[model samples]
Target: MESRFAEPSVLILVSLASGPKHGYALIKDIEEVAGATLGPGTLYGALSRLEQRGLIEALPAEERRRPYRITAAGAEAVQAYLEHVRQVAAVGLRRLGAAHA
Candidate 1:
């Protein structure tokens, strides 16, 4: 099922792919990597969904902050999704270049 929160979900997954991170770390990482800012609600909501889907798992709470890591399944999913995006981007760029030429 597609989620209205797809973008944030993907961003979170991608960030976690790098390493486990708590909510605030995730926010900073995602912002640094993607130039997108996720508010607390959006970050937590996507984290819950990812956890429920078995794509991510939360580690033990450390100082009241829980870090999350991507599962093997999550890594696979993100790789596939990014490959598809790359293909689409390449085609779009090629078409734009052709039109300009």
Candidate 2:
């Protein structure tokens, strides 16, 4: 199966790129950032996959809350994805041709 990033995962990584955050913190931040709620299973699954892929790392455990940070690869991937989104938007806007509307 081809590995693909869910939108929530991408958003989570971008949020963490700024700094480390614990699980609930990440969930709250992402919900605010994306205006969507991520279920517990989905959130944990994404975090596990991201860590396994080396795109993120868990910090030392502090109680039940373990913080995570975005790896260098994660930052690069997020940047590239954002750039691609911008390019795609430009193409779409150009195709619309404001004069026609």
Candidate 3:
């Protein structure tokens, strides 16, 4: 949870917050939304960790691809993390504006 992989984990969770998606869909969604391209190694590594932590669960494979969905705990964790990010960004922006003024 607390590692260099945290960002990717959060991105994955946020992507799943909308609905379930397979590996390739998750990669595309993260790239499109966050402008960060996750290689297969990084994607699957984080996926493994998240699964171990109970933040996500893999659904039955559709042909060759396995879709994943965010659990309730995953939603709660992501919501809290994002809220903290929003607060930090708000403060930083306010300070920057004050300094400029």
Which 10 residues in a row give candidate 1 its minimum summed lDDT? 1-10
Alpha-carbon lDDT, every model: 0.92, 0.85, 0.93
Model 1's lDDT to the true fold?
A: 0.92
What TM-score, over all chains together, does every model reach? 0.92, 0.85, 0.92
lDDT of 3 by residue, 2-70 (tens): 223448999999999999999999999998877788899999999999999999999999999999999
lDDT of 1 by residue, 14-55 (tens): 999889999999999988888788999989999999999999
State the lDDT at 13 in candidate 1: 89
Strongest candidate by lDDT: 3
Count clashes in each candidate, considering only residues at least 3 apart in sequence or on different chains: 0, 0, 0
Scored by lDDT, model 3 comes in at 0.93
Better of 1 and 2 by TM-score: 1
Which sections of candidate 1 miss by over 4 Å? 1-6
Query: Could you give candidate 2's per-residue lDDT for residues 10-84 as a string of tens digits?
Result: 878878977999889988987777666778888889999999999999999889889999999989988998899
Decoy 2 TM-score against native: 0.85
